[model samples]
Target: MARITTPLTNTEVKQAKARDKEYNLSDGEGLQLRIKPNGSKLWLLNYSRPYTKKRVNLGFGKYPDISLADARKLRAEARTLLAKNIDPMEHRDSISNHQKEKIENTLLNVAKKWFQVKKSAVTPNYAEDIWRSLELHVFPYIGKRPISEITAPIAIKTIAPIAEKGSLETVKRINQRLNEIMNFAVNTGLIHSNPLTGIKAAFEKPKKQNMPTIKPDELPDFMRALSIASIKIVTRYLIEWQLHTIARPSEAAGAKWSEIDFENNLWNIPADRMKKKTSSFRTVN
Candidate 1:
């Protein structure tokens, strides 16, 4: 006849102390609390591997952390796996690896990878602004989640708060930026398809508001105000230069004396300074 192993009580587990060497307190069929001389208690489940006759021990966790109740729950799960011809250790190991992969491939991690290539196409200051926007508005919400899990619903929920605050334009820009990041993930094989494709449809389309241009009637007041404005003289000159040359603030500010043709009355700007980077010659008064 086979000897029967009795189940251990929670009191026995708590009162048990480490001795001269390692000792085990068995809780029935397979669960055991192994106490070491170093004052450590570990939960182990001794079981026979399915198919093979050899036995092995599967570690649950340390005592107090795993607790007696938790150890028994794990032991019962291991027995269920054994009944189905699966190795408990291997199954647990597989789940652990998947979780590790998800942590490694989070949204913020993939965004950094995308930004490395994207930064080369833009100015350093613009790149910094782009990253700052992500850190402020997006990262706190879903950046830690895996890139593969960024579905449209989750994305819509994230930016909805911004939209509610009457920043629809900001929300639109964020959507476009996020779409680019997700596309990069797809191209790099991080995800199969871009789940953010239809996310824009989930929100209201931003209404078009044209840039505030001075009307003909308002030109006199504008010039009169500019003449007495509190701004610096150099700033006044640059604004007038921008008005005349029909150039953006950045383009007008970048003008150099070398680009001026005194004889021809032409401002020969460099292609690099222009927004379109093609038109270089402009007639200036």
Candidate 2:
């Protein structure tokens, strides 16, 4: 090996390589530039691994940007990391892992997984409706794509079709589901931010809220008309109680005789059967 010395110029480095395809240009202070046949040049720092006789390849920056001067500086930093008992490459890998975890926990990924784990939360009749909307409306378009890749444009496009069908209420529900999924993802360190945040207004228009009750005067006529009309006994009682006590239709049907005390004319709704916002109470009618 030809020995290199300090104060070497760029011309000397290039010329010395003309005679021999493989040569190192000593840039003084333990830094050397190695040139290969393909005209590729790399900077190397001469150093021994900590407590070991073996030499290790620190790294090289892009040519020109990492000039001989800058190359030495990087080598010095790498040496510093080594002195602190850290491996530069290992540190880089750790950073990469952290970034990957952030992406995995993004709202999009969490939304999908939440749907999977909470399928039982929704009724069997409505479960498929929810799944189809997510699969065709959301997943096919953005599923398998990284959570970090979701953007406002993508979100708007994905939801526009559903909104056009006058399913604004459904879209609202979907948005809430996405929000919850993203929250779980955030807790798990899968995503740092939720794209679903502030997404309700993104829908083209606000959803139409269904009227929960009729005018007070309309109740008497409604009850009179239903009592005279021929409807299923269960249906008649359900509509009457729903109107009288403002109970949800689903809850009225799931109510058991055991839970109702006819002697007291009172009904008690348990927490398990109540809707999202309904109060669990012992109602006296």
TM-score of predicted model 1? 0.67
* Top TM-score model: 1
Report residue 26 deviation for candidate 2 (angstroms): 24
The local lDDT score (0 to 100) that residue 54 gets in candidate 2 is 65
* lDDT, model 2, position 23: 63
The residue-by-residue lDDT of candidate 2 on 1-285, one tens digit each, is 966576667576545442247667767655677777766677776666665646765556545667656786787787787788777656667988878865665545666677777665755435556777677677777776666666657777778788889888777876776677666666656667777788888875564678776797897887799988887887897877776666666777677777787788778776566645344655556
The whole-model C-alpha lDDT of candidate 1 against the native structure comes to 0.88
Q: Estimate each model's TM-score.
A: 0.67, 0.52
* Highest lDDT model number: 1
- How would you encode candidate 1's per-residue C-alpha lDDT over 1-285 as one tens digit per residue? 997988888899999998999999999878899999998999999988878857899999998998899999999999999999999988999999888878999999999999999877764445776899889899999999999888999999999998999888888888988999999999998889999988888788889989889888998899899999999999999998888888777768778898889898999876555545565787898
Candidate 1 segments whose C-alpha is farther than 4 A from its true place: 1-4, 9-19, 48-55, 94-109, 140-150, 161-168, 186-193, 207-230, 240-247, 251-285
In model 2, the Cα lDDT at residue 164 comes to 88
Q: Could you give the C-alpha RMSD of every candidate to the true structure, in order shown?
A: 5.0, 9.6
